[model samples]
Target: MFRVSLLFLILGFTCLSCKSEDKNNVGTTEENIDALLQARYTKLLNYDVDSTAFPRSYSPEKKQIKQVPSKDWTSGFFAGNLWQIYKLTGDSRFKQRAKQWTAFLEKEKFNGRTHDMGFKVFCSFGNGLSVEDNQNFKDVIVKSAKTLSTRFNENIGSIRSWDFGKDRWQFPVIIDNMMNLELLFEATKISGDSSFHKIAVKHANTTLKNHFRPDGSTWHVLDYDTISGQVRGRVTHQGINDDSSWARGQGWAINGYTMAYRYTKDKKYLDRATATADYFIHHKNLPEDGIPYWDFSHPDIPNVSRDVSAGAIVASGLVELYKYTKNDTYLNYSKKVVNSLKTEHYILPKDLEVPFILDHSFGDWSKRHEMDEPIVYGDYYFLQTLLRLKEID
Candidate 1:
């Protein structure tokens, strides 16, 4: 029952009547997407949310909305999306809304329980800063990076990605952890602290050595012995199984290393991004529509639900990758995904359907399931992809 249903998408939507792509309006692609997202977000604003609770996901079938506190790893995405809308539309309403939601996450600068400060603080405050100069946002980002750095183990040459799995993992790091390095890289540029950059490079190097397979697919989790600096084991705790390529994990590498390459101008990171992107592009299980099954190695491929979130991540990353490489491959492929995702089956039919935009985002397919649901990160990445196209593509 893996799901991101086509039902809600096509059945009751206003935007479906809109053209999927206006080749003539290549100049207005951002405008079309922005209007649709703005309407989608208007519905979200009308929902009975606490504002601070942070809308995490919604199940259209159950008509339930899921919210989390600021500490949740996903806390920043909602605000980040708001910031992006403001950036794209230059609408003061979007800016004010972005600020309102992003303000709730300022306290997260002090949170050290996990290594997701980048997702929480950077995506929110970082995007806020991008909108306008804010000293407060700058301070929060620097301190959050410092807090994130606290988790880095010089012995292990990587940041510890988990806290609760103490018995199961001595020093665990996930491919998703590659994300925090982006924030750290930015921190160095702002603070002129090479220490932050060194930590980021070391962590990425450690991950490059351990997390990836020969075929360029990445393992979800890797545990290391800090003292020996040796990988204790590799496993896939959040995917279909230990041996499978989790869909989002692939998205992360494609997105993460693109950021790495952008910041460092490092060809190695670009090459790494290319490797993972190629694997994903050619994977046999990839649907013709450009979305992927929750796991590339799912036991039953076409039968499993697609993770539109993964498609969004890869699409967004490819747009950025296209800018760096000037390769039409990434641009053309990303545009195809944008066209595919525009269908009523993937995106919400209208603002009235749900507070969220896209559905069928899979957070996990193992225990503690988040299958075929709307996820905040999915909304963020998809909107982000649109914004990237607006700016540079």
Candidate 2:
């Protein structure tokens, strides 16, 4: 009897030991994942910066002494991504530099511009600066938001595009503008002004009516009839056209709508974001490396350049979608793209001179076609995605 009791006691202890071991293993796995994320987060915060306030893009090569004198909305997008990374990691350096960029945009030069104020200011100032609640930064954002709100046309119910030579396009709205609505929303929240929110919602609704296709692919540019208050034509300025999908433009829609859903909890925006994501994932043109070409329809173009920026941006949005839906598929897709980025082209292993992922990113087809260059937005999204993954794990 005593022997039987001893055997049963030993068996019970053995089972308990096995369970303990399993728990330990799981904890170790999670810890290792967190450590990996932390390392990558540190690397991203270390590199990626606006070399010059004048030109707000990534410059790994020290080619120009004077800050490259150009303005683009994509640079602002990258800065905004960096701000997000800082928010997750609590890294002070990221916050400081993000503030600096916001202050730079407060300049009279960049204030009321139209090409992609959402990418430029909303991401950088509206999202980036809002976390810290710095009064000066808030003031800068409010000013820019007011400027953007003024650009809204009552007739067309949308913001105008660039001030290119002629005022022919009175109410031209690009799909990219959908991302800018957050600035107006933030402005409304901070200033207690309802008009800002009204204008933002109107523009978002206008985009939903005209910018998206039946398949969820988005048009790059939409020209509106300011007098008639109607959409004139859907054209792709830097893309293939209204009929074709630009990979980056599609990415902007995915990220923009996901954000819209986050702020408003509107089911339509979430559905649109998912549909756009599905189009990107199932598209036949994805390269062997998992990064996509600049435009999905232009696959026949010889030596079609891959846009790492698109991959990074879409990956970040996918992770966000996963959070909302708890869909493992979205998480796995996001991981695959991020892993492809880390293993294949852009990611520097360690101890590299330049502080960016994916070398030779093309900014626009109009210039710098084949060259392997670093883009600011690529680095921004890459870092932002990494930080977000850390939070999830």
Candidate 3:
């Protein structure tokens, strides 16, 4: 009778439920996980998030899913996740869903108010193009790069990351800006145009020149005088302090540099990624389970929530770094991190069909926003890490 009920529940009329991790589970192997996630998503349809919009985070306080508009920074991740699932399972259902969700952002190909074009478009369209070779998607990516390039100033040598904070910042460049370069890099490669490539290289060089501390820990944001084209100051928006090694910032450093290396084959980028990874991995505050606290320098150690998002990003990049350097240590470390995530500390319950894959990630510790909850980007990066892990076979 329970199996009959479950079959009916898999149909569209029924909503899925959540499970706590302590409920005793199985399927730790990669193949097992692949089959499980595939079955879960295929059975569990529109409940993940608003099918019309992108998911941002779960508001535990509100006990609801949060969504952002098509123009928002996180808009691409939901569609990107669908495309990734399509790639993993070759399910036409997911592919069709990916196309439908991706279409919501078609207008954003030319929207230039924000610098997250890469995150907004490439993550959705780029991933789709990778598997399907769609020219329409290809054109949207090229146009998105052109739109993103409008924010680049030859004088400033980096794309502007924010439009707000005019009183506090003339031109703000955040380490998170590094993630956007991939769209431009792929644009240049596909279009056979070096313009986008030049912008990416310049942004990368400028970031490398100014963003890193001597120890490879990074300041989250750098403000430059828009007129003078020189740095004005450095600040931390979400970090514990102005000088602390914000865990996600360090993760971004390695992941972004590793991505730049993929396009440029520049040894400097890889070396920078390696240095940042070394700093993050060796930091004393990193937990024994391989998950990192919200910030390495968070004043209250052993009393803070961990950032599974950073762990996912770091592990995904390490898999790429392993390919570049052939270092078993990087691969081994990545495996450890992946293993840790599947552990109860991070993994969701086996029978549940929540949109989120992992939990206990800090959204923003300082603001008390969604702290110790499942994060949208965390789920995306976790999927990326799993996909990378499958490549070893």
- The TM-scores, one per candidate, come to 0.90, 0.78, 0.90
1 or 2, greater by TM-score? 1
Per-residue alpha-carbon lDDT of candidate 3 for residues 1-393, written as tens digits (9 for 90 to 100): 012124311222111112224332543444444444444454324444344557677766677767778988888987888887666656676788788888888899879999999988988998889888788998999999999999997898999999998988999999999999999999998899899999999999999999999988899999988788899999878898888888888888999999999999999999999999989888889898778999889889989889988988898999999899998877877777777766544665545445666677777655768788877788778778778877765
TM-score of 2: 0.78
RMSD of each: 5.9, 11.9, 4.8
Please, what are the lDDT tens digits per residue for candidate 1 over residues 29-62?
4445545555566655444435567888887767
Model 2, 105-205: lDDT tens digits are 55522466664555666667666555866676667667777777778888888888767725545456777677677777777778888888888788777
Name the lDDT value of residue 278 in candidate 2.
90
For candidate 2, give the lDDT. 0.65
lDDT, candidate 3, equals 0.80
Q: What lDDT score is found at residue 237 in candidate 3?
A: 84
**Cα TM-score of candidate 1:** 0.90
Q: Rate residue 139 of model 1 by lDDT.
A: 86
State in Å the error of residue 377, model 2. Answer: 1.1
Winning candidate number (lDDT): 1
